[model samples]
Target: MRTRALLTPLVLAAVTTAGLTVAAPPALAAGPDISVTNTKAHLDQLQSIANANGGNRSTGRPGYKASVDWVKAKLDAAGYTTTVQSFSTSSGTSYNLVADLPGGDASSVVMFGAHLDSVSVGPGINDNGSGSAGILETALAYAASGQTPRNHVRFGFWGAEELGLLGSKYYVGQLTTAQRSAIRSYQNFDMIASPNVGYFVYDDNAVGNGVRDDFTAYYDSKGLPWEYIDVQGRSDRAAFRSSGMATGGIFSGAETIKTSAQASKWGGVAGKAFDACYHRACDTNTNLDLVALDRNVDTIGYMVWRYAAKDYGTTTPPTGSNLLANPGFESGAVSWTGTSGPITSGAGRPAHSGTWKLWLGGNGASATESEQQTVTIPSTAATAQLSFWGRFDTAETGSTVYDTLKVQVVVAGVTTTLATYGNVGADTTWVQRSFDLSAYRGKSVTVKLVATEDSSAQTSFVIDDTALTTT
Candidate 1:
């Protein structure tokens, strides 16, 4: 969980035609490395905007509104539902930008937030531009990924945070009880790119929920040392934590003196403040640790992807004569035997007919994921056909067969790969794939879809609208 974007990649190519240049959309990264270049580009925008508006985007200031407008425009263009929530402050009126991915369970929302406002004294690049730009790029990348999530994903850019977290407090104060409860998890990020950074995950023990575990695990996986920091009643997290929503996030230390041991572990000055600039005029683009900025933004992207497909292992009872339980995944992950997070009702990709589908692979790493169900065909049936609609999207090209989706059959625990689909011809159209099930009549068999991908690039396999019919 972390914060801030809108899109138009930094290095996108264009075909110029007499001052009418059309820029091509940049190819999206599979996950995590959702383009550090894009994140930095967003920070560049924030820096320039601050420069044009009195060196700061403090609450109720012209630069703050410009920041909100800029981020909203990007999200709007990328298809997120954007809203500018205005609140009154002592100075004047300030704004918060909220953006949501279109689909996912409305009852449970996973949110990533960062304060967009800086202090009146400086540009606040590392103080928060790191976080703001990080989240914005993450949002834009999610829009480009086209994988719908299981839980609703929202991004918030708050206002007046430097003024004692007033913006987030005000925003939460306005939510109805039901609306507040709906935001099941909130992750706050502030000052993530200190010049001398210390990776710290929020730990209130009672309010972090399990998000801290995920955050710690991610750090461990990367071999990055991290420590738990108490952020309760501090920063924007206080607003959500006090509202009964579970809260957690990471903070690169701000204004704290670096200890000798911490320096040895994380590498930087031995005793200087983690972020020497903190909120001063020197807190410009030059004050950032680009390495920390890239890594944290990548982590932000990873977390968003994780929560988007998070499944709580609950499902609805099978209905109708389809012979498959929760075939479309609309009722969560009912009757599914493989892969914990693939059955998604996300709106990023079109389902065959409904709001849910079985998604596998596209993690951008060497991975395999699948979904399966077991059923017995009646012996008396004259004909039995197993069919489903499937669609595919990929970052791999040119027929080398980097990723593959195998439709398999398991009879008496003997697995057989029935058909193998690859990235070369896997289009975004919903095409029917069928296999005769007459051979398995009077016997129980497991129908499975297994997707495998190499370490680079991603290929997503989406399946839905299944039926097993006999007459």
Candidate 2:
């Protein structure tokens, strides 16, 4: 990781708050608890260390190792047994600092983690340094408050995170099968607090539970505008999610630009992305908007206090497999009897070309080889109807014309031309074409496609979304 020098003075003067100065001690404002406020100062200390060393804290680097030492020392001082899980990686030798707060039932554990590695390009202030500092603050606060969470609470500082989650995957992979089962939930904070002005609560639950709604209600009750995002395999949460553990976190912004519409809804400036430094060297101490960052830290503290601090609810197994959640047609087969034309090679035809075109030998270069699949779709009698949508691409030879398309349907073992279509010229836009099979309502309709016109033409038809809809 390389840090770029920002010759320009950070725009810290623009964010100065009344009676609240970064240069002064951080005790004038309200905090979760007195200890929690000190935790914020803890972040300030880390930020100072990272900034002093080339404006970054990256894995295998001196700044990164210093950050690890600081966190491990903090955990050791907190009366917890600490372990340094070191592993070799392409980036270099790195380590994940883990500390256990064992509970009455050590069998069940709750994990709270944030990647300690900053981006190689920048100080990674907003990307993950923000997240790491917040976790430190929370852990210190948890220690000072003497809040004994029921489940064993584990804190982690994952290394080499900038190298595509290598540290987290290693930690998860090393766990024995029994230890893996003991994990009840994983709450990871990758970029909890950014100088970015907007708030987001990620939804990582496999099933869309009322998590987002609950999170919204919690923040809205505090007069805050909170945005919702799905944990779509963006960070360390993916590791826990793959192992069937409930996962979720909060993020300000990484590198993704927020549109004007989003900025309008949220009060951040438009055109500028949520976080400007994202993964750049400019992410120094002054790069953050502390007002926004502190608020997000409190937000995360609130969520953890409510969910991981104590057990208010239990997680249930999913009712159904994700397979049925979004079932899709993989492949199928169709057959048609027409003018027996020689199967052409080199050129493929679209499956939507109809039967008459097959008789004319102008459908396509290749003829149907055999019947592959016959699907039976069931629909409500009230609004049952069969419809098909397909796309056609003209032959590539740049010929004056290409193949024509048609379709055939089988009802009660009787074959007939259900729909007829003319030549579909090559066009880039999707042509929305439909056919009414209302006559076959509530019945199994077997369908086949043809692409035979001037057997010499090599046009092809691509078919999609063949369905029986109740409309």
Candidate 3:
């Protein structure tokens, strides 16, 4: 996940010149001592296997299969229930190695994953052997050290990732709708570090900017220079994010070069892709900068330990005020008013009654012209009270249908049916729907409303004064 830059000719030129001048140097600061004797040992094993097979751990290759077995044996020895989820593509059969260290909320999980397959080009030593080695080391360290993470921590070693995040995509797709909802987050280590050096962090675009701030805080605190890069599906993190999970990872530069500007910010030679070997055959064990690799291992390991373990504290419940309040000029909320629009209908779908025209809000929320808008309440609240105003027109034909509506709170996509109201048939007046989301307590919710439909479907409905009050 860690890497940066767009390769313009100019950028390349700058990197080449700067790289020649700035030799890959190791970080002076000492990383916490994790017994990586095993990590180093595993690296050697992977190297030997790679060297034995024409220096390649290509997918479907014997060396790759051997690598999978090696990891499986280690997990088994560590008392993890190892399972191989296999799939096939045009290339060949690939495997995703999953092992569970059941703990904490069995339902809520924290996943730690890395890709085990290397590029067909060479032993793929630095390309991923490094990541595989690091993860193997970390997992074994956790087992040997006798430290238990509070949350159910799952480990995965993906295959065919170099081919485009295939393993992760397949894994995420296999989860039942219910299983997907229980995941807390995913921490990925694609390339824990590079012997080539430089530093950067992977950014998941779906997530808010808070992750970046968290990284800055950590790097700045350690006086370590780091850069940020957009995450490409080149790794497993991208796949997790695609499934709506939050993701982040550390990297020590790759084939992409650091710019003068980046170097100034992160203190690396401007214009060099953090690591020179990248995917090349030269990406051997010797190419790695132990200093950079060591620091990254410690930095990421600690972060995983802290967040995945949930050591910070329990999340607080939303307040009664926050729950009862509605958004408006009073609560600093923005209003989205719908104008008259054509009504469409279709057969019943899972989440919708019929076909509909979806209007996405400026904030990226979907809404209908006749239905109420959706609001996402912040998680910081202790107890929240949500209130909104809805004006409905129940003027119908043969049936005496009520001008009713439904309000719901969706926490992490799991909807909580809150309240349903009938505005009294034929009533074209605004009714207040006050719902106490206190049951959600510590959870954040995306508020949703569906106005009841009648034969006399109105052209449009107006909603205003939506507020979520926090105690």
Candidate 4:
């Protein structure tokens, strides 16, 4: 039912890349710090598009197609290869805008997507404009960065999601087994900037849990709290998951009231629905929570970089000789400096392979933490490889502010960034990340993991099974 007028509308509102160059083995680059202001600009454009084509961007409507065109144009201008996939919907012919960033592993693709259509009632800015605009802005950021990732990143602005996931289902149906298997992970964002927001993470599956953990880590680092909301079959993710694809995402909330406990933790009024305008004509630009929108958009970039930026080898590493001491934190931060305090170790949380893991930030904990250990290389070794399993969650409040995780190589007095991870969105599952240390083979070097949390909205960062070996 259209409920805009029946609920209170919160006052909060408002809220990329390219390049050439083949550099040294890609050091883990920081995901672009997304701009809330730029996100607001996209919302304004969507609002304008809706205002001109009819009062709504609904399926089979002029506004819906126009929204697709506008998004496609931006992607094209930014150098993303774009395509419009047509599908038949009850309302009529609808289109989905699919944009691909070239130069990643085609066999293993990572998708960041959102539904682009609104219900027929209003502008639907909050119900979906929040998500569509957020994903669109993140895509543009990727183009601007020009960083070649390890997995192909695909962006989908789906149509008819409001009409029962018609567009997404169609798109998924068109994929062959090979195509489906190529999708390593799919992340969806819907209604992320709800007015009276609650930070909710989608807990769909094991992979979804990893995604949830990433967001959990981010909120933890920022000193924010979150709750798990099972949204199976609730959004476009339903379609992808139904097709056997791994998926995860974030939602600010909708219609669900903020409990007193939630209010105490998140600092919002109790008894108020996260969004007062769910599927109503008043879900306009003014109906959003700027803070929520900004953080989620930044998270989209983080997840893209962490998951899409690397190739998860098809097989797990064989357990053998590992050189780093206290590799899994099972013995607690021993052999590492600056890590004896603040670091957490224990059971309960899922681990990559052991009963313990090192947590850089705990749930709802905030601080800048680091752990370093100097490892002496055997003069006889001509090359070395560094490997570790890590998972994280970082939040971006704006273009210049966000949590971060960096793995560094220090020799003498100089520090070289080996890799970085942040805005993990929801990565909770353990994934292995490796680096070649052949460059420092002959010298004693300090291998360090540093985590930095912003002043607000922090999450967690975890690592396990560290190893350095000559191969």
Supply the TM-score for candidate 1. Answer: 0.61
Query: Per-residue lDDT tens digits of candidate 2, residues 363-412?
Result: 45555421112223333334344454555555446534445555776655
C-alpha local distance difference test of each model: 0.78, 0.57, 0.59, 0.74
* Candidate 4 wrongly placed segments (more than 4 Å): 1-31, 206-208, 314-471
Q: Taking the tens digit of each residue's C-alpha lDDT, what string does model 4 give over 120-149?
A: 989899879989999898888877886756
TM-score on alpha carbons, each prediction: 0.61, 0.57, 0.59, 0.61
Off by over 4 Å in 1: 1-31, 313-471
Each candidate: RMSD: 17.7, 21.9, 15.2, 21.3
TM-score ranking, high to low:
1, 4, 3, 2
Candidate 1 Cα lDDT to native: 0.78
Candidate 1, residues 1-471, lDDT tens digits: the string is 112222221121111223454344333334567687888888889999999999988887899999999998999888776656677888789988878775565545789999998888888888788889989999999999878576768899998887778888877886655467567688888888888988888875687668877777677667677777775455688888887788889888876688777787789998898888887899888888889988898888878998888774432222224555456665555445455568877776778876888888878899999777665566666767888898999998797999999998887768988899988887788899888888887766678889999998888888998877676
- The local distance difference test score of model 2 is 0.57
lDDT of 3: 0.59
Q: Look at candidate 4 and tell me the lDDT of residue 104.
A: 56
Worst 10 residues of 4 by lDDT: 9-18
